[model samples]
Target: MEKAWWKESVIYQIYPRSFNDSNGDGIGDLKGITQKLDYLKDLGIDVIWLSPVYKSPNDDNGYDISDYQDIMDEFGTMQDWEELLHEVHQRGMKLIMDLVVNHSSDEHAWFVESKTSKDNPYRDYYIWRPGKEGGEPNNWESVFSGSAWQYDEATDEYYLHLFSKKQPDLNWENEKLRDEVYKMMTWWLDKGIDGFRMDVINFISKVPGLPDAPNPEGKKYASGGQFFINGPRMHEFLQEMNQQVLSKYDIITVGEMPGASVDDAKLYTGHDRDELNMVFTFEHMDLDSGPNGKWDLKELNLLDLKENISKWQNGLNGVGWNSLYLNNHDQPRMVSRFGNDKEYRAESAKMLATFLHMLQGTPYVYQGEEIGMTNVRFDSIDEYKDIEILNMYNEKVIQGNEDPAKVMQSIYVKGRDNARTPFQWDDSENAGFTTGEPWIKVNPNYKEINAKQAVNDPNSIYHYYKRIIALRKEHDIMVYGDYELISPEHESIFAYTRTYGSEKLIVITNFSSEHVPFTLPENLKLTSSELLISNYNVDKNEDVSSFTLKPYEARVYIGK
Candidate 1:
């Protein structure tokens, strides 16, 4: 086994637009992030994974990068970004930028030239194909709905965009494009930043000769995952990237791979593999996704959640590392999605935190998660700012003639804007997010769930997170321990144990609102166990054979 700085660190993801506002321009910028460095420092964050701040047309909320070298005008100038990097380093915290090279904005110079003409030298930089039989090149569907191929009148061909039409997929088969990407990566690492969180990195390499995906529902378009995810040359390309740029730096790299598997993850993040340090797998996130994928909603299966988490932990143990997270800029808040967001909001939030942070991987805390920020269900679809939500509503309800209320219900629960809403800082008019109008509506619960109140209250979720982070730093077993799932068949209890040499830790979480009786495994004894952390106050001397845990309760016991 090996020890790395990244394995011992905790990452905090900051969605810049929703984090804070400094200029009161209704948008958060680099200066605003600098203003809150001290607050994050107090929260015990070691690495700050800032979402994409590159120059863009705002097509996919900055994921569509038009310029890799420049900062977005809305997020402040190059100097502001420089000061932010310096300040984060000054506080002993590392900063990692989002690497969105899987696709570049259609407005980028490469794409502009690529679409100019068929013979253009840069034409090979993007994936373009002639139409087939008076239709698209393939039956593939865009992640945002409709055909994945967009007709370009200028080039007399269609370009592939797995996401929005404004984002064009890059041709990774081109050596010149790969060289340019590597050079751009080196330029950033040389600029004194940490590393990158690669956006859809696994989708970069595609199978030769684009093919039609299987249509299960007989829809007009099909899921292109079979032809794109972890494609033929993914490892080859990543290794070249590592050899050309990443290998030269002491930085961490995490790939945002949507459809990758445990076997694929091991190859990508294995210690011997010259690729990324870790990867984000979405098996756990997809537990609630129904037949038609994410848009088709279904109730979350608690036992499935436990199985998925435990599988990852066991599969990656000693092979590669894992990146633990329940919420991000793209997903609804964890407390709102997995826990009771009404009565047991705080309790369930703490319980979920205990379950994730005590695992055998580095944990990520999305901004405002420390205060149990729940989902926001705006009254109408027009109130939504996320392109994905709006597109789904338009396609499903407006065009497909589906039930309007039913579609809205899915949007309310799964919309990305639920997490993209401005961070609630106080009880001000705009939740202290901005004096001017916020880019998105603030969650109305901010008055009672802002950071100000959490910071002041010792028993708040914020402080509880702080204490859990401190314990991780203090315990070597947290990072190096071997994990085992206990009672994997338990429907309401998510329980696991971590053991490193003689040190052991038992983490039990009640995921339901009803009281449940918990019986420890016969192999485990608690005579010498010390309560390390718990969401609810518990009697340590109570009988271990039959203990009833309150609703949404979590307890971590440390044993010698």
Candidate 2:
């Protein structure tokens, strides 16, 4: 297998709208990111993946891009973006911009022209079908709730919007549209940007005939993913993209691919595959969801989590690479979701970080995750801003047969907004995210858990992350070693080992609040084992004989 730079690098995901506000406009901008380059560098990040900052209508909070080549007015100008890219490269770091070509905002020029006249040449740039009888063309459901088909009275046709109605899916079957997309991607690569994080790139291709999916509940709406995700011509499109644009530049590309199986992942990222370097799979991320993709608020079993991770690790061992992550803009905080957020927040956050970073793949740290930030709670659904959450609240709480308060509680605990809140920089007003009112409310726990306080405390999650990243760079095994799950049968603890050459690292993490005694694996000698890192303050020479692990404690030991 070829050695890819991104394979051995740690990528940090930055949600631009919440990272930092430089112009006092209640929104983060490019300049703010430039100012924070030193912070990222100090944290030992090798690649920075900035979420969508392109021209948008904010319908899906920048995901509904209106222009691919231009920067959004709120983020900054094109000049600012160029300067930021230069700064990142100068600091020995790479920049990966979000490539959201699956759909475009309804305000985009192509969509505007497509909706103008039925005979327009650009009409084929988007999916358009005549209404069925007196209703929508199909019973497909938008990811944001409601019908995926939006009726255009002018043309008497309905357009497909897998997400919000304001965002319409692009017609990839058109060769002209594909060329345009490739041209735009090459333009960005020509500008010296490191690479791209393809947004729902697999959803760009759709099954032919636009067939109506079987409605399990006889409801008018359900995810149309079955008809679109990883469509028939997905590989062909990706291979063409790689040959025309990506192959020209030695840049990293990670696709946001959902509903992709292990075999499908091999097709997209295998050594023989030229489609992508890696892909973000949602198998582990969707553990808490119900059978119908709705919130169920169930507790995650540690053994099940380990099994899930082990399957991906072992399945992709020799075939493809994995993009490991605990939290992103679309998911809640890891500390609050996977780890204990109330009593042992700091310890559990660091433990979770240790577990993820030591995995045998590229690791992504979402902004504010290093400092143990958590979910946000609001009094009403009116306080929420995410389109998915708002739509779910309306469907399940306002219109369906579910309790509004219970639905709101699920939203508070598992909604994407929990991770979208402004970065908590200090204990000051608005968590020091902006001088003006923030676009979203800051987490109330910011007063006790902010960057300002963590930076000065040696026992903070922020410093722990810095140390682990430093360790990864110091030891080559941490980056390219093979992973092996050791204590898979443990109920409340997860243990794994990473080995490369003569170096071996054993990582043990307690996933519960109750202290548990664990016996060392058989034949594992401790005389030569050196304690590398621990969430708790333990001396290097501390005896391990019958040692009992405290709640949420994690330790990494290095040996022959």
Candidate 3:
């Protein structure tokens, strides 16, 4: 495999709104991020994938882009962002901004002009269609809730918005619009920014003709992803994007592609495709989502996780690269979702980190994840801040499809807000995220899980992550090795091997909080092997095989 700086470096994701509030304005901003550069550097962050801080009405945080070239007033000014870039560069870290070009805020100048009249020049810049049979253009569901098409009184037409109504989808089919996007991208790259973590980038392309989605559930809104996800023009647009903007810069690009299959992922991330460095696929993350979707929560199936991850590893082995992550700004805390967050949070977190970092991919560390941040369970729906969760709650509970209490429980377990709470820096009143009232409540357990405590403790999850990251830099095999799942049928253990030349790395992870016995395959011998890292330190003279793993224990062995 070819070598690249991004493939070897660890990318850390920071949701700017919750990272820190240097101004005590109850919102994290560019200055706040700059102030914490040393903290991230100390944690061994090589690339920072910052969530959007662009101008928006805060409709869906900053995902709704109001001004592509301007910074949100709430997140400080362009000058502050420039300082942040400088600080990150000085610390030898690259900064990648969130690219949310799939949609623009309704308040954006383009959207404003588009909605003015049917013949407005900017109208074609966005997806607009006449209402069909006195209703929406199509029976498409907004990811948040309700219809995907929002009526525009002035233009007597409806605009497509896969997410919130305030976020109108851009017309990627328009050459002029595509050129504008590319131009904006180059502007950012020319401004000394690293690259982008493209937000729902795959949704940019839609199948021609307004189509109605299959309403299997017979619900009010129907998910139309089948028509748009990886549409016919996706590859053409991406390749054009690469040629026009990305290929000109030596930067890393990762696309967040929901509803993307392994085949689609291969094309999106293939080195020869000139599309993206990697893509984030959610197949593994959806292992716990029941038949009814995300809200219908179920126990995580370890076997399914093993199959999903192993499929990506083997399927994309030579065709594409992988982006390994367990938690991000949009998902629940890893420990809370997959591990015993209360009794074995630290152990399980370290175990998860070791399991993923040992793979042949670039690993991402979400802010507060290094310290084993668990999910938050607010008492009431009003305490939540995520629009998706609130919208789902209203659609399901308030509208009489499900019980409110049960839905609240689901929200506590699967809601995106679980990851959006203010970062717990210390055990201060607001978890040291801000002196003023936090935009969202901090987890009450911050006193025990803050970074200050983790840095002081050598056995903390933070140190374990730092060690794993350093090991990745030291071992090329960790980044470019061939992956083979060991004991693929193991119900509670996820074990894999990465081989590069004569060097071999065996990673074993206990997915559950139970004693699971594992015996090494007879063909594989560990007598000459050395234990590289483990959640529970392994003695140098320990036996090579046939041992019972402790709850949430993880071990990595290196050998010839």
Candidate 4:
């Protein structure tokens, strides 16, 4: 494969609404992000992937875009966004905006016009189907929990919405719609933006006829993923997109695909495929979920995680690429979900970072992740503001009469609000995130885990992230080396080697609190060993082979 800037870059994901609040209205805005550019620069982030700052109705946060070319009023004005872009460029960093073409806010002009009447010129812009057998057009379920089809009184038809009803699915089958989408993308690219992180890009080309989903359990509306996920024309649409807008510039592209298979990913991201540069696969992220999906939490089997990730690492070795991440705005804090957020928070956080950064792909650092931030456990469901959590609570507790305590527990462990908490800039009233009441509550542990304390302490997780990011730039093997798993059946220890030319990079991570002993494979020897990085301190003269690793410890050794 070829070397690309994005392939070696460390990308930081910023959830704009929760990042920093410049105005007293208590919502993080574009200017606040501009003010924090130096902070991100200090952390050694090469690229900033800003979550949707586009015009929205706050439905699904900013993922439900209202306008393709305008900025959200809560986020900031277009001038503010332009200044932020200029500042990012001036600092020698790049900015990649989120591309949310999968669906649009119901309030968007296009959607509003399309929903007026059947004869409207824009009516075909959205997927509208007639009722079948006095019920929904299809038995598809919305991702946000309801029927995927919303009835329109005016047209007497149903429109498809894979997510929230407010986010109606666009009819990609319409040539005019595709042209409009391509034009909007071209408009953004011409404005000097770097690239895009396409949201649910695979769901655009759904299966033909919008077939009914199989429901063995016979629930009202089961998942129709089989009909839409990595659908028939997914590749053709992406290739057309690449030819129309992406190939014209020297930029990066990553698709946010949930159910994409490894083989499907090979075609999407292959070097000669002329599609996306890489894809954000959800295979590794879903390991902790039970058969019931994200809400039904289960213990994360270490071996399961190892096998899932190793498959991707080796599966796309020479054919395609991967987007490495543990947490995002839609996921709970990784430290709380994967590592110990209590006793060895800092150590385990660093260990997680070292574990992910050592992989052979571009690593994403969600906002507040560099400082060891944790999940929030509010007193009650009323305290939460996320739509997904609130809906689940309503259906399970208020509506279905389920135990409120159990639902709250699930929210604490798997809720998206845990990651949406305001950034802990300091120990101040709102974690120094806003002067006014925040749109959402700040994490209560801010006094201990805020960035101010982390920056002041030399051994904090923030500085550790900076060091690991710098190390990636200093070593080519970290980015492009061949990955090989060691002791694949190991339960608690994640050990792997990345070999580039003659140098080998050995990484060992302990995911548990118990001390674990590690030994090099018989075929490998550290005759010219160098300790590159570790979460635990070690004497330079201490022998590394067959040594016991402390709780939440991670270390990297390079050998010739």
Candidate 5:
């Protein structure tokens, strides 16, 4: 397999809004991020994937871009961002900004002009169509809930917004609009900034006719994903982007492509395809989502997780690359979702980290993930700050007249706010994230789970993550090795092997809390085993072939 710096990088993701607050403004900003570079450097992360900080209306927590070339007032000025970049580079770390180009803020100058007239030059910059049958052009549901089409009184037409009404979908088919996007990308690369983590990148291209989503249930709206996701002109647009902007620079590019399959990913990230370096696949993430969708929570079957992860690992093995992650700005804390966040938070967190980092791809560690931050459960929906949660509550409880308790239960489990709470720095007020009231509530367990507490303890999840990250740099097998699943049927154990040259690494992770017995596969063997890393202390003389794995116990072994 080919090797590159990005292939071996351990990326740390920072949701700028919740990381830290400077100036007592109750919001995290660029200066706050600058103050924490050393903390990240100590954790051994090579790249920082910062969530969107561009000038925005904060409709979707900065995902709605109003000015792509400028910084958000809430985040700080351009100078603050530049200084933050300089500090990160000085610490031998790289920074990658979130690129949310599937849509632009309704407040963007282009959109503002586009909505003013039907024949305006900027009208084609966004997707607009006349309403059909005195209704929406299509029966597509806004991701936030409601009709995807929004009526514009000024233009006497309707516009498509896959997300909130404030975020209008861009028309990538327009050559002039595509040029504008490429020009903006070049300006960023010229600023000496690192690459981008493109948001909803695969949703850029849409089917020729904006057709209605299949509504077998006869619902008012449904997902039109098939028409837009991995659309016909996706590869063409991406290759054009590469040739025009990305190819001119030396930087890493990763796409946040939800619902992308291995075959689609191979086309996007294939070495011969000149499109992107890697993509964040959602196959593994949807394991717990019931038929209804993300909010329709269900038990996380271990076998399902094993199958999903192994498929991506083997399918993208040498053809393409993967972006490994569990928790991010959008999902709930991973430990709380996948592991016992109460009694075994520390152990399970380390185990999950071990499993992901040992894989043959780059691993992304979300902010607060190193310290094993668990999800938060607020008392009322009023306490939540995420638009997704607010909109859902209004739709289900108010409009749809569903049971409030059931809706809140789903929110407790899957709300984006579970991951957006202020960073737990210490036990002080607001978890030391801000001197004033935080934009969102801090998790009450911050007293025990704060970074200060974790960093001081050598056995904390923080230290475990630091060790795992350093180990990745110390071993080439973790990055470029061929992967093989050890036992596909084990319900509680996820074991895999990576082979490179004469070196082989066996990674064993107990996905459950039971005291399970684990044995090597009949065909696999370890002649001379050396313990690489483990969540539990190892007895040097313990048998290598079989052992009783503790709750969420994880270990990595190196041998022939």
Candidate 6:
């Protein structure tokens, strides 16, 4: 097997809307990102995967793209984008743009034309089906908690939108639509971008006939994913995309696939598949959700997380690659979600970083995660801006059986906007994100947890992440090493070993606040090992035979 450059690379995902704001326009922009290039460079990341900044209706924040070629005016002009790309390259870093071709905003030209007339040339650009009986084309449901098909009075048909009704799914079955997507992709690749982070790419291919999904709830909308996600011609379309656009560019590609299985992942990212470099699977991320796939106040066990991660690590060991991440634009903060954020935010943040980065995969750090950001708490639902959360809140609580206040509490804790809040830069008003009011409320704890504070504190999570990333770059074992789960029976502690060639690294992390003692494995001798890094202080030349770890403590030891 050949080693891929991206396999050893550390990717930093920037939710541009929250990263920085340069124009005092209440939103982050490319210029602000350009100003932070040095910050990222100093962090020792190789690739920067920015969330979508294309022209959009802001329906799904920026995921519902309306124009592919132009930059969103809210972000900046084309010149600003070019400068950002140039600055990234100048610092020896690569830039990967989000590819959201799975769907486009209903306001997009193609969708507009498709809805205008049935005979329009662009009518085939989007999925349109004649109404069945008296209503929608099918009983499919949108991910945002409503009907998937929206009736168009002008066309006398219903258009499919797997997400928000404002966002219409594209017709991947159309060859012309595929060509148009390829052309836009090539245009960006030609502009010197490094790669793409495909958004919900698996949702592109859908089975024809627009069959009604089985209603497990006996309602119109349950299990609609059967007709869409991982459809019959997904690989066929992906291979065509790779051959036409991706193959010509030596670039990295990761697909956001929710329902994809181990076998499906092997097909999408295997060395011989030629589809993608990696994929972001949602199984680990969705552990806290209810059986209905909605947010629930459920506790995620550390052992379950470890088991799921290990399964993927071992499954993709020799076949494909994995993209490891703890938090992103769609998820809450890692420290708050997985660690003791209130009691040991700093230590646990560093511990979480160590636990994730030492795994057998490419690591992606969301903006502000390096500084141990926490989830936001809004006063009310009106304070939120994420469409999905609002829809869920309304459906499950406001008009349904669940308690409205309880649902709101869950939204405050797990809403996507928690990650989308403007990056807190200082204690200033708006957390120094913008002079004007930010699009989303900044986390109130920004005063103490902002970037300015973290940068100046040597014991901060930011500095720890920087050190860990530098260590990865300096040691091949940290990047390309094989991962082995150790002490799997431990309840509150997660331990693993990474070995490459003759080097061996043992990473141990305490997932809880309580102190725990563990006796070293008798079969393994580590008398010659040295502690490379530790969240808690260690006595000089301390023995590893038996050790007690403080709350949220972690250590990385390299064998001599």
- Tens-digit per-residue lDDT, 332-411, candidate 5: 99999988899899999999999999987889999999999998889988898899999989988999899999999999
> Candidate 2: where are CA atoms >4 Å away?
542-546
Per-residue alpha-carbon lDDT of candidate 6 for residues 165-186, written as tens digits (9 for 90 to 100): 8889999999999999999999
Each model's TM-score, in the order given? 0.99, 0.97, 0.99, 0.99, 0.99, 0.98
- Looking at candidate 3, what is the lDDT of residue 361? 82
User: Which lDDT tens digits does candidate 3 get at residues 1-560?
Assistant: 88899999999999999999999889998999998899889888899998999999999999998999999998999999999999899999999999998999999999899888888899899999999899999999988978998888877888999999999999999999999999999999999999999999999999999689998778777889998888889999999999999999999999999989899999999989889999999998889989989888898888898888889999999889999999999999998998889889999999999988988788999999999999998999999988999889888888867888899989889899999999999887898999898999899999888988999999999999989988988999899999998898889999988989998888899998899999988877854788889999677777867788999999988998
What are the Cα lDDT values of the candidates? 0.93, 0.89, 0.91, 0.93, 0.92, 0.88
The root-mean-square deviation over C-alpha atoms between each candidate and the true structure, in angstroms, is 1.0, 1.4, 1.0, 0.8, 0.8, 1.3
Q: Which candidate model has the greater lDDT, 2 or 6?
A: 2
lDDT of residue 90 for candidate 3:
91
Candidate 4 residue spans exceeding 4 A from truth: none
lDDT of 5 at 49: 88
The TM-score of candidate 1 is 0.99
Q: Which regions of candidate 6 fall more than 4 Å away from where they truly are? A: none
Model 1 per-residue lDDT tens digits across residues 244-305: 99999999899999998999999999999999999999999999999878878899988888
- In model 1, the runs with Cα more than 4 Å from the true position are none
Candidate 3 residues lying further than 4 Å off, grouped into runs, are none
Q: Candidate 2 residues 1-560, lDDT tens each?
A: 35667888999999999999999999989998998999899889999999999999899999999989899999999999999999999999999999999899999999999999999999999999998868887888887878999999999899999989999999999999999999999999998988999999999899998888888788866667888999999999999999999989988999999899888988999888789989999988878776656488777878778988998887888789999998999999899998989999999999999999998889999999999999989887888998899888877867887988888888877899999999989999988889998888888888998999999998899999999999988887777777889878999989888887888888888999999997778755555788889999877766653477899989999888
